[model samples]
Target: MIDVKIFQTPSGEYTGFQMSGHAGYAEYGQDIVCAAVSALVINAINSIDQYTEDAFENSVDPDSGSVFFQITDRPVSTSSQLLLKSLVLGLNGIQDEYGKKHIKIRLEKQEG
Candidate 1:
């Protein structure tokens, strides 16, 4: 199953997200769940980079199917916030369609 962690501030603002594991719904190349998750994540990252001035840190591990993206700048920009929110929405939709067996999403409070 794909595990997703969405980090948020006390006031409910998004700060970042981390994703790991494969959907195992099908073979790697044919897993629609994984594809949908990848598309949303990549699009959100690219959109934030291209459309906003927010600074972020990201790391990807193909071997482990792990990805981590964090906004490094404080008081995140509205554009970046919206992009991340869209990502969360897309991910949730995938989870709802594919079921918890394929994907799991959890909300986490950002640590100091």
Candidate 2:
């Protein structure tokens, strides 16, 4: 299953997100759930990089099928925030379609 954790600030703003694990719905190359999740996340990351000036930190652990991203040293810009929200929307759609065993999403709160 693909596990996605969205981090929210105390005031309920999205601070970042961490996604790990594979859907295992099918083989790696053919898993629709994996493809959908990857498309949503990668598109968001790319959009943030291209359209926003928010300084940030991001890392990927291939061995663990994990990716982590967080805005660093500053608040996220409007464009980045939009992209992040879009990502969550897409992820939720996937979860609804594929069900929990294939893709799971949870929210985590972070104190200021």
Candidate 3:
């Protein structure tokens, strides 16, 4: 399963997200679930890089099926947040279609 962890600040700010694990629903390149999730996440990251000045820290390990990301210091730009929201929307759609067995979405709140 693709474990996606969404972060939120105590003040209600969108802190960023982390995605790890593989759906294993199909073969490597032939996995629709993996493809859909990858597209949504990569597009959002690219959009943030293109449309905003806010910097984020991220890492991707294809071998381990891990992608981790979080804000550096500054608040995330509105465009980035919007794109992230859109990513969530796409993820939700996938979860709805394929069920949670393949894609797991988690929300984690920060204390401070």
Candidate 4:
């Protein structure tokens, strides 16, 4: 299963996210669940990089099916938060469709 954790403050602001593991819904190249998750994650990272002034740290490992992204800049920008929220929405939609057996979404509370 694909495990996605969204880090947020008690006030419901996004801080970071970590995604790991493969859905194994199908063969490597044919797993739609993995593809959807990857697309949302990569897009969010790229959007934050290109459109927002927010600084962040990220690591990606395709071989191990892991991706981690966190805002390094204090007080995440509105644009960055919006992009991350969009990502969460997309991920939730995928989870809703594929079920927890294939994808899992977890919200982790953080001290802001």
Q: Among these predicted structures, which one has the highest TM-score?
A: 4
Compute each candidate's TM-score over C-alphas: 0.96, 0.93, 0.91, 0.97
Q: Which is superior by lDDT, 1 or 4?
A: 4
| Best candidate, lDDT | 4
* Clash numbers, per candidate: 0, 0, 0, 0
lDDT string for model 3 (1-112, tens) is 9999988777766667899888888999999999999998888888877887888899999887798877665566677778778887898899999989999997899754
Can you tell me which runs of candidate 2 are displaced by over 4 Å?
none
Q: How far is candidate 2 from the true structure (C-alpha RMSD, Å)?
A: 1.2
Candidate 2 residues 1-112, lDDT tens each? 9999998887777868999999999986898888888888888888888888888789988677799988774466777778889999999988988899998999999864
Question: Tens digits of per-residue lDDT for model 4 on 1-112?
Answer: 9998999989899988998999999999999889889999999999999999998899999998999999988688999989998999999999889899999999999988
TM-score of 1: 0.96
Better of 2 and 4 by TM-score: 4
Cα deviation in Å at residue 73, candidate 1? 0.9
What is the lDDT ranking, best to worst?
A: 4, 1, 2, 3
The 0-to-1 C-alpha lDDT of every candidate, in the order given, reads 0.92, 0.86, 0.84, 0.93
Error of 1 at 34 (Å): 0.5
Q: Give the backbone clash total of model 2.
A: 0
Better of 3 and 4 by TM-score: 4
Model 4, global lDDT: 0.93
